[model samples]
Target: MFKIGWLRIANGLIYLYILAPLAVVIISSFHPGEYLIFPPQGFSWRWYEHVLMSGRYTEPFWNSVKIAVVTTCFSLPIGTLAAYALTRYDFRFKNAVQSLFLSPLVIPTLLFGIGLLIMFSALGVKMYFTRLVLAHIVLTIPYVVRTMLASFSQINRSIEEASVVLGASPARTFWLVTLPQVKSALAASAFISLVMSFDELVVALFLTGPGLNTLPIMIYSDIQFNLSPSIAAISSLVIVATLAIGALLIIFMQQRTRKSTDIEDPKP
Candidate 1:
């Protein structure tokens, strides 16, 4: 009983640590004053209005959406291929190839961004929206690959063999048999890639110049020049948006899991 009490206390503390900052930010965002203050003097939606009215904030928000969408689109196919190769096939240098594909996750983001900027400059590639999209895709691929690989690992290989024995081509077998098994993982991976690309700041900061600021970059610049409740308002908005996406993904994956279980075990 004493050990259980200590464990509960520790868990409660950890939860508090995680939620304290978010609670503070959400409260600060409602401050009636122009600048941020804890235990706000008054409460109002004026800051939210300011965030909505600001072109600087809205433009970058849109840019973040475009970049995240493009990043997911590009990353999904490449990551899925890499995951399939890693999980399903035997090949020379397989470990090396997997490590190389996942290297971005291990490397420091700032260093990676600097190297990319230098390399792109040398290649005469300008830092623009398309380039930013490509960079985000590179950064987000590892998450998709890792998640999909986990999903693929859990699948039974004999299903593929059974399909082939039934006269299905390898491609047909994969499309008809393997894909349904791993669909939940793909959905989860895509959501993760989308979130990672959307919330990314370091690479975006280095790559984005004038006319290409993402929402995070805009928030960074705004904080640098001024400290306002509106910044908190923007942060709150982003936090809510991201949480909504995450919750939807979780709900989707749960439904998929239930459906997969039902397919696996039918009742008479």
Candidate 2:
């Protein structure tokens, strides 16, 4: 009981450490002051209005949404296929291949970004949006692959094998049997990949072309030149949006899990 109490306290403290800055940012956004400060002088929505009304912020935000959406579309299919292959198939250098795909998680993002830039230049691909999406896809795939692999690990392979042994084609088994089993995982991976894509900044810094930018890039530029409550307002909005989406995903995954289990369980 004592150890459990201590653990709870430690966990609470860690959450405070993580959430304190977010709380400050939320509070600062509502401050009436032109400059950001902690414990805010007073409450107002001027900064929120500024961010919502300004084309400067909205354009880059939409740019991020476009890049993230396209990146998710490209990354998820490739990542899911790669993960399935690695997890289910035996091959030469399989461990090495998995390592290569997951190496980005250990590698420095700046190094990865620079490497992509050089590789793209070597290939003579110069389009801005094309380059950014490619970089994002590279960055996002490893995450999708990892999440899907973990989720796949939880499922029983025997079920899939039974489907195959029952005369179902591999494609049919995957679509009807395997896909349903991994649906929640796919949703979770999609959420993670989308978040990583939207929150990406390091790769964007290198791959972004003239007149091409993202929300993070805009925030970076703003921090470098000027700091204001407007940025805080944007940050708070992003936080709220992320929390809302995350909550929805959690609820969806939970409901999906319950439904799946209910379907599998025999009636009493």
Candidate No. with top lDDT:
2
Tell how far residue 26 is off in model 2, in angstroms: 0.6
Give the TM-score of each candidate: 0.93, 0.90
The pairs that clash in candidate 1 are: none
lDDT of 2 by residue, 1-268 (tens): 5789889999999999999989988888898987778878988999999899877799899999999999999999999989989888999999999998898889999998899899988998778888888888888889889988987788888999999999999999988988788988899888998999999998899988788889999999998898998999999999999999999999999999888778889563
Question: Model 1, range 1-268, lDDT digits (tens) per residue?
Answer: 5789889999999999999999888899999986678999988998898889866589889999999998999999899988998998899999999998899999999999899899888898875898789888889999999998888899999989999999999989988999888888888888988889888999988888877879888888878998888888999998998899889888998998888788888773
Off by over 4 Å in 1: 266-268
Candidate lDDT scores, in order, read 0.88, 0.90
RMSD of each: 1.9, 2.3
Best by TM-score: 1
